[model samples]
Target chain A: MRLGPWKIDVEYGHLALVIVIAGVTGFYLADTLQVSRNINNIILVVPLAMLLLGLCLLVVTQCIRFRKHPVQKRATQLPNHERDELEQEQSPMDLLHAFLLLLGVGALVMSYPLIGLDVATLLFMIFALLLLGVRGWLFVPIYAASFTAVVVGGASRLLPYPLPTLLF
Target chain B: MLDSSAILGAISLLGSDINIWLVIIPGLLIGLIAGSIAGVSNTMAMAICLPLTLYMDFLPAVMFLTAIFTGGGYGGAVTSILMGIPGTTSSVATTFDGYPMARKGLHNEALGLALMSSVLGVLVGYIILLFVVAPLGNWVIRLGPAEMLLVALWGLTMIAALGGKRLSRGLIAGGFGLLLGTVGMNTSGYVRGTMDIPFLLDGIPVVPAMMGMFAASQLFTLVGSQFLIKDKAARRADYRRVLSGFLSVLRYPFFQLRGTLIGVFVGAIPGVGSSVGNLIAYAQAKRTDKDPDSYGKGNPKGVMAAESANSSSEGGSMVTMLALGLPGGGGTAMLLAAFAMHNVTGGPQFINQNMDIVYTIIFGNFIQAALLLVVGLGFLAVAGNIVRVPLTILIPSVLVLALIGSFAVTGDHAGPITLFVFAGLGWLMKRYGYPVAACVVGLLLGRMVESELIRTWQISGGGELAFFLGRPVAMAFAILLVLSLLQPLIMRKFTAWRTRNRSA
Candidate 1:
């Protein structure tokens, strides 16, 4: 945990920096937000400052907590052994699959306007099913029939929230 | 003092009007359908349905909204128990035990407990809301703007207290959230980062952002994971087990009622929602549980605490939205917007001004709660198969639905863009462990806080220094704010002193 001349838990460095910045910012905001008599002065004084100071203090404390614990860092950690092991170890196949999925989702978003909700959803589902390793022409009718059911029964009949008219 | 006949009319209102019944049943079914799906949330349901409410009468319109409000909550636990994904942010804690229970072949038991727990929770919340709304409204009226602001500020402390075992990181994250919250136009009439974007003029949409962080970000993580987590949950849970859950909750009606009241009261506070309600209930349940470790697992009490608070939060959330112009949750925010579109105002006076509309909502929720209990049981029985729908079918549909939901709020492209921006920002903050709730609080409260502050100042002849304090209610709120700000420090000092004593 030590690093060179600074005999400190290296883990705490990031947390300390984050907290100091937040705490100092909060301290400034609290000062700046002092209640002023003039309406304009008070407008600048209150709310924005108090919120900032409050949030700053919040970040400062949490960062300090982050410094103290290893478990808390997992989801937010930039890259340590665990994150790298999981993320970096992805095979080229996995990379390709992920890229295609992203591309597909992006494409679906684009198609939403032209195709409309029902057609677009059906297309997205069938495409996703194929990519995820589901096989056979059997899905065509099953997909179409279920898609209709979902659109007609679920969306049209049941959903209190109506879908787009999909005039096209 | 209470109007008993009006309550009877409420009961009849839900039953007699055929169109309203049509609206209520469909709204519930749709909410159930959407909620069971991975990405469709209660907010999304409400947003999409915003337009439909435009067509209905006040009573039926509010009924449909209430149906969506309660049904969506029950729907969210579906994905949590079955798929290990919480459809709503509120259900994050559910997965801790629910998913595990499902994996252990206790799916029926888990689903059973969660369903029953949810109904009981909302039922209790409804009952509490029924009694407390009048007295609570009186209390709220007595409070000043300063106190309201203080309550909002108190909410921020939750970040530092609950973020993690660490104190500093929590504050930093909260601070960053508050900073980002100010990115849009401020109360000062100065456009901050909104610069040229007209949509940005309104400030960041926290709902889209929250959904992005909680739902969309999870999709990224899910994409990263090679396989969808599946469950081989047990096929059969005896009716006895389900009945026992009811018996157990009934045995401790006081606890359930108390928890429900807390959820309602908490929910009525502007900017607080079911997520806060859920966590507060979790903490309370854990604190009071004889065996604390059993909570994070598949304990019935754990399920009971979360579901009750979470469901009850709906009633709590609506109380403010319908009774006071302020909103307690995303659904309520959208609801307030609906009221506005229809030329309705929502506040304590709104109820006084429009008792017919208000009474309809108050009584409709009670009837809906009882109905949802029956409907929820049927859904829970088959939710295993119902919730088994793949994310592949789910994601694209949700993407389309999110677009539809956002657009339904405003029949234009701007709403979708707001949804997108919020989604992206939500994903980033959630990834980095920032609190999205604070940002939401800031966004929703930002305008109101600004207006209220300005109003207070104007009333004080621009003498802003002591203007807020001059109002008796505002002064009380100011005191609450100071106390809230000091609480963390006080607790920290106490904890430190205790540790030092232990060491000695």
Candidate 2:
């Protein structure tokens, strides 16, 4: 896959996921073992984490082997063809849209307490709508505000706990 | 098991109360709304409405709460079918086929199947409860920690089936979920994965994390789509298709029966309720089905199996609460609280002394189940319109609703934060062909798996292999688990042998 001057391999994403799992599991296992070497305490965590780590290693090895002999693997495997076909079907722009939507959701959640649930929600709505190609300046804000009001207002009244909000 | 005097007493009690009859509709509606929402759970809905039951008499209050319980059971299927988001944990399996059906422009049928299955599940569950509440309660109580651990393991087997063709990815996702599930404090006071977050002490909020993984992550992937159903012509909510779906459930009576039975047995066990019951039922359905590959790809039988188990599990959970005074799960716990409020204790004594009241509750649920068919039909008419909404509007709106729903669940920023974090992980997993459903199941059962294992170990006096041999129930479950795991292979071999023999 190419983007401007950069070449990207989608296989790296799979490898990255494996690494994240292994890293998190390893750190967690170390922390758990540090807390206690008792069988009762570590029984589940130890074996499960080790299994996960082992699986991660297995995945990493497969990725490395595949990369090392891409041509041979591509020739032998049928799933690679299917996967490549699927990759072709999904445009780079679609990936960008997904990434941007994720970023938008993250920002909304992070700013929730500071900016208030209502404001954060409003901004997120507008951002998301525009990002998803909802045009017209007046229509976007109107939809965002109405949605925010109904959800936030109803939530405030119905919920036992108060929601943090700068605007009603 | 059938007491004539109790039956007479139950009939008289039910006939005497107009208030009880009146509360059933409202209770069902409340449950439906609460259960259909992205983040709000049935238990949460019941808890919120617990106070309102104060003004009513004991019978009415109990009936109302149970009504909500029954309603919420089916309500979760609505969102699960129309959108990919399961309104409650129990409905997770519903999304497996329900969402796919929705995407295929068969949302009406899916909704209908879910509704009919849920109704029948409730009815069958209550009927079983009516006859064998005492025996079932006794059977459930005998199940020790080892048995519970086996049950959790049974649920975990679902990961293998859910993995699709990629067994390795499925195992990795499931293993990662198990690790994530154990992030908070362990049963033995060992905390490992909290990372200093306060909420981590209790463990990651399962509901919020679940919403993140299934709902938000799914929404992100839908960014490129114009609508949930891409075909504009197919997006119409046809009542005829809905009716067809409803009647179609009868075609798989055995599947529905199997699911209901699984739900009852699984639901009867304390702490393991509809959530595990639905998954186990779905797994069994998939394992037994001739066309297993059709599952998770808009198979109506999958929806029926899941809905039946989850809805019927409500009745199964009620067995412990009614006969043993033990709450099987959170919703039953709320019912027990209602029991306490009325100065009523649930146990063998309660059942022995107040058989009439027990019969009344059972009979009342029968009516609730029947009424659900009518109420659910009306509810679906309104809720089915969700498919018509364009993705441009629906995606962000649902995402925001999920965030708020998560916030409502946690009552703090932790919920929203967890939602965002898990959403990213869910998206990555989805992108790379890993099963997010497997991960969600792992996370859901992770804590239970650990606690039950620890208990089993303690009972065995430092994990002695001999300890399991002494327990026949545990041994039986182990055998069942082995058989369940190997059934696919055995079936394949048997088929091959027959084919070869035929050729000869």
Candidate 3:
């Protein structure tokens, strides 16, 4: 089944997820194995082993299911199970919009430590408001600046510690 | 035996501390508003508000938080009835009939029924909590480490059930979470999966991660929507119709009672709270009704059934948190954080030592229930208007608050960074139908599950397989786990066989 507007395959996504999890868990499992094993360490190892095993089963079963039922037909299916030609084209645009939103937000988050919280947030808000199709340059700057100031200023005042930022 | 002194002392405790009582109203108000807004879940509200609790004493902080919990259970129903959007998962079932009712211009009636049912549900849930928690606490005190592990495992199983048909995905996500949970050093100081990062040494900051997964991810999804409710005329709130709708709920006592019962029992189970309760209750009500097909089509009973069960589930969840020290779901996970903040462990020891505090929480809920009826009316009068606010403005605003809230939690860049990372992760998981709730249950309960597993292993003398046989309760749990895993698969096969035979 496709989830959300992005048309991401649920089964394949889950398979990919489990594989990554298994790989990470295997790395950790190897580390614990190398460590000297006491009774306490043995206790910790048991659950990790179980988790590793569970991930393996999840990935394998998902693979079998995927093989039994190929992805093409399911991938194209809309949530309402309707076959509308117009919507088929429309959803991809929606997906692109969603991707841009996520990318913008991600970039802003990464910038927090690099550039600073206040400056990054102000830029992010302006970008986000524009991305969401909020027109009028006058409304954009005022909304972005005021919102960022309220957040940064209010947080600086109320928070138990100072926010990580180079400039207000 | 009930302690008369504890009862009297609890009453006196509230009477003495005006601050404890004062915070409850604001807590309820915040919860009501947060819950009424779709995408601002009770968990997010509690998490965002959690930092504020750091300023207060233990009792007041907890009371305030719990008051929010109580109000939020009902607040979700408002949006469910008024708009098609469910404010919280607890209210998802409500929208089945509630929105349809609103479509028929019975919006006022639907809102009223939802409100009345919610109030009664909260009252019934806490009333059950009042009777069950103390006795349950005593019984749970006798449970050994093995049994505790089983309890944690049972909670994990509930996560799968919460995923509906996405069992494999849920289990895998939960497994990943358990692995992530062990990233930090164990009790023996052996670190497992920190990847050599200093910040990762203590493990993922749970509150920020939870806020990201539950709140921020949900907000991102709503980012495309123009407004919460598309219809302008439906957004108007009529007090007279709301009143009539409120009184109309009294007509369906059976639905309310059934829903409340379902909400309480199911909600009491760790990891399965109001979200499932409302669904099961609504299903039962629909199945048993004279016209089963009438469900999801403006049925008043459906609204009552869903609202009552979901609302009462708050009390049910509280029972688990107070008596067992295990959170029932994400909302209570935040409460558990509050407990940690207060240096208060919720369990039999805490219960026995501080019966007065326990009783105070219950009694305060009773007052909250009464206050909810009054406060909720005022809230409903204004709640409908929020649907008119555009998501473009709402999303950025809430995201900023969430960023600040996370920062407040960790008092470092770690908070905001974690929030951003998990939000992206959560959004991806949601988009793929991986069951973010399962991930949440896993992340929140991961430490407890592993800790209990280690404790059991230690008690059993270093991985002794025979040790399981000695513990009857743990053995019973083990049996339940095996059955829970196998039963679904077996039932699926049987259904296939039956369908094949029927076709033949």
* Predicted structure with the largest TM-score when compared to the true one: 2
CAPRI tier for the interface of model 2: medium
Per-model DockQ: 0.17, 0.73, 0.38
For B176-216, candidate 3 gives per-residue lDDT tens digits of: 66667666777677776677878877888766776677555
Q: Which digits, one per residue and each the tens of the lDDT, describe model 1 over residues A74-123?
A: 54565443553354244556445544654555565556567765666566
lDDT order of candidates, best first?
2, 3, 1
Comparing 1 and 3 by TM-score, which wins? 3
Candidate 3 ranges beyond 4 A from true positions: A1-19, A36-39, A42-90, A165-168, B1-24, B30-69, B72-118, B161-165, B215-217, B220-225, B230-361, B380-384, B462-472, B497-504
TM-score of chain A of each: 0.42, 0.81, 0.66
Give the worst 10-residue stretch by lDDT in candidate 1 chain B: B225-234
TM-score, candidate number 3: 0.73
TM-score of each: 0.67, 0.95, 0.73
Best by lDDT: 2
Better of 1 and 3 by lDDT: 3
lDDT per residue as tens, model 2, B69-154: 99999999999988888999899889989998998999989999899999999999999998889999989888999999887776
lDDT score, candidate 3, position B52: 91
| Model 3 agreement with the true structure over A68-113: per-residue lDDT tens digits | 3444655356553234322323255555666677677678777888
